[model samples]
Target: MLRATSRLPAGPSGSRGHSRPGRRLRRAVVVTAVWSALVVVAAPGSADADPGLRLSNAAHLAPGVRYETFSVTASHGTAHGHLLTVDLDDARMKIELLRPGTSGAVTGIRAPVSRLADARGAVAAVNGDFFDITEVEHPGVRPTGSTVGPAVADGRPLKAAVPDGQRYGPALVPGATDEDVLGIGADGAARLDRLRLRGAVVTPSGTWELAGFNQYALPVDGIGAYTSAWGPASRARASCGTNDVRAAACGTDPYEVTVHHGRVTSASATLGEGVVPRGSVVLVGREAGARALRRLRIGDPVHVRHRLRATGSVPLAFAIGGYPVLRGGVPLDGLDETAAATRTAAGFSGQGRRLYLLALDSGAEHDDGLTLGELARLLRALGADGAVDLDGGGSSTLVTRPPGAAYSTVRNHPSGVPERPVPNGIGVISSA
Candidate 1:
C-alpha cells in the first residue's frame, strides 16, 4: 500500500486562535487540504518533466505486454534504447527467475538469454544480476554471479539472499541496496522491495551458521546442499575419494559431508549426481560444519533454514543490482556524472501495479548511453515511481517471445563482442 507523510497543524487551542467550534472546524479544513496537497506532490510527478527521449516502435506483444524503442539526445551524449512493459492484468500468467540449463541442475555454466528462455519456455526475458565472469579450470567455476543476491522462484530459493556484513553496492538499507528488486506474488501482483537472505543448519544438538548455498566452500569449511529446486542440481565435486567418501582436492583443504532425511542417509567427499532426493538434504564442507553433521545419526532432527524473507510475502523474487536512479518519481543521487554507456534498468509504476524493463543499445559513437540521472528522469517521465539499474554495458540484453512464438528473440544489440552469457535472467511465464 502507498503511504504519505505530512505534518499536521497544532491543536485547536493555539496561541493565536481560540478553541471555538467554528474556528476549530475552519482550522481542520485547512489542515486536511494541506495534507492532501502534500500527498499529491509526493506522488509521481508530471510526465512532461521527463528527459528529451522519444518513444517509437511501440507494439503490443501480448495482452498486458508491450515493447517500445526509444532515443534521446543530451548534452552528455545521445542514446538509443528499448523497453518491455508488463501489466499484471492476466490472472493466469506469471514471472520467473531463469538460471542456466534445467531448473535445478547444479552443473553447467552460462548460456544465452535465448537458450535460457527457450529452455524454460518463457514468453519474455532479460539478462539479470551481476556475476563472477572470470574463467576457471573447475567445472563448478562457471560464470555465476559474485553475489547472485536473493532469489526465490516458484516459492523455492534458487539462490540464497545476501548475508549480514557482506552487503555491497548502494541500497536504501544496509541489506537492501539501491539495486532494485522485483517480486511477484502467487496472486499475480508485482511488488518492489529490498530484502536479504540468511541460512543455518538447525539440529537437536545446536545450530551452525552457513556461508551460502550452491556455491564453493573453503576446505574444512561449512556449506549446504542443493535441492531439486535449485537448478544445476549437482553436488560440489570433491577432488579425492576414500571408499565412498569424497576427498577434498582443488588445492583447497579436504572436508566431508553426510546427507539424509531427518537423519544421516549418505556421506560423501564429492558432490553426488542428479537432484537431491525428496524429503532429504545434504551437508557438505569441513571444520565446524563437518563436525556438526558427524555428530548426527539416523532419525536425528535436522532442518535447513534456507528461505527468502521480505517486508511482505512474495513467492518469487529476482535482483538487478544497479544503484537506484529514481525513487517515487524523483531522481536519486550519485548517478555517474561523466561516463555514459549502454544501460539496462527495471522499475515500477507509481502505484506499484506495473513493471518495466529497459535496455539501451550502443548507437553512434557520439550516441553513447544514458547517465544514471538521465535514465532516472526518463523512467520518471515514463511513469516509473521507483527504478534501479541492471547489469549494463555488454551484459545488458532484452529478449521476448511472442504469444504464439516457439522461441524467444533478442530485441536489442549487445555491446559485448558477440553476446555474453549471464549468470541468471528474469523471465515472463504464461500460466495459461
Candidate 2:
C-alpha cells in the first residue's frame, strides 16, 4: 500500500520534489489513493490510522542513527518532513542540547542548526526551542536570544524558564507551563518533564528567594540570578513587563548586586550589563524584590545557590525547552487544530530507547505545514508514545551529516531564505 519513490540526494534542495500546480493536483490524487490502501496494512481497531505518510530516501548516518524524508497528504495540501531515528541503546549514541557558543555561554546569539551541529560535532540536529526573537514591545532593549524554557547541557543547568506570559511563540495549551521540558536522563532515556528553579540569595540579613536564573524575563517582584553562562546581553529587559502581562510597562525601581567569591562586590540601583565573570553572580531584582536586595552592602558576605529541580527521579543529563503535544500515544486536548505551519518536534518510544526528531518542510508548492493536532497524529503513526513540539514556523529546521561526511547539511527547506538562526537545538552525537 505504501508507495516507494526513488531515493533523493542528501541536500536541502534535493530532498523535496517540486511540481507545478497541475502536477501537484495529480500527485494529490495519487496520494489519496495511496491513503486508501494503508487501511489494509494498519492494525485493525488501532486508534492511530495511517495518515497517508510515506518515508523515502532513507540513510544511516551512524550506528543506530537513521535519517529519512517523509511526505503526507493533508486536507490543506501535501506536506514534506524530515525525520531522524536514534537508538539510545547504542553505546556510541548520545543526545545533547545545541546552543550557539561552546564556551559555556547559553544565550545572546542565534545560529543555524547546521552551524550548531558542526560546532558540536553532532551527526544530526533539529531546532530546539521558541525564543525571544524580537523586541517590539520593549523598545531599546535587545532581544536576548534566550529559549522559553529551561536548558541543561552536559548535565549542568544552564538556564531556567521565564514567566509564562513572557514566553514567545504560540500560546501554551491548558495545563502546560513555561517550565515544561524534554530531557534525557542519566539512565540514558528520553522523557518529557518539568524543571523548577530552586534557588536562594543568602545575605547577612536573611535568605531571599531566587525566582529566575539566566532567563530573559523574571516574575514580577522576584529576584533573578545571572552567571557567566548568560552572555553579555543587557539585563534591562528582565525588569520590563510583569509576570501576568508580558507587555506591561517596565518597572522603574530596579536593583542589581554583584557577588564575587562569596561576597558582595558591588550594588547598583540600576540593572548592569556585560558578561558575568566566572565564579561571580549578578542578582537583579524588581519592585519589592529590589527593595530586599538594596539592604546588602559592598563586601557583605553573600551566598547564592541555584539548581533545576526535576519532577522526575532520574537526574537530567541534557534538557531543552518545549511543550508536550502527544502523551501516552494520545494528543492533548485543546491543541490548535486550525493554524498550520512548518514545525519541529521530538518524540520517544520503546521505553525511551528510541528518539524521533521531526521537522516539516516549508516550500512554496507544499507549504501547508501540519497543525499541532495533525502533527500529533503523524507522530503517533510514526510510533511515538510521547512527543513535544519545539520551535516552528521559520525556526523549524533539520540538519544531518551524510555517511562519512565531514560536516552536517541542512536537509529541509527552511522558510527563511538565508536560514534563520535559532537560540538552541537538540543534537545527536555519536562517538563511533
* Model 2 / residue 371 / CA error / Å: 0.6
| Candidate 2 residue-wise lDDT, 1-432, digit = tens | 001122211221101000111111111113233233222223567423545778889778877788889998664667899999888878788898887866657667788899999998999999998988888887888888888899998899999998888888778888888898888999999888999999887888677778889999878767899999998788988887766667777778889999999999999987878889999999998766677777789999989899999999999999998878988877888887777789999999848878999999876765888778778777777777889999998888899998778988887874456679998899999887
Best by TM-score: 2
- Please tell me which predicted candidate would have the highest lDDT against the true structure: 2
Instruction: Give a tens-digit lDDT track for model 1, residues 1-432.
Output: 000122212222101000111111010112112111111112256323323456787676666667778776643555777877777655544577777754443334667777888888877788776553433445453333433355565666555533222233322332235223666666555666655445677666666665446543222234455555444424443221211111223323323444566666666545554556667666664434444555567567777776555656655444433456777676765565555667778887766657788888753552567666667766766667787776777787888887778877787764444567776677766654
lDDT of 2 at 306: 90
Which 10 successive residues of model 1 have the least lDDT summed? 13-22
Write down the TM-score of every candidate. 0.69, 0.88
- The total of clashing pairs for model 2 equals 0
**Which residue pairs come into collision in candidate 2?**
none
Model 1: CA > 4 A from native: 1-51, 105-107, 135-147, 162-180, 215-225, 230-256, 265-279, 285-301, 313-324, 363-367, 402-406, 414-417, 430-432
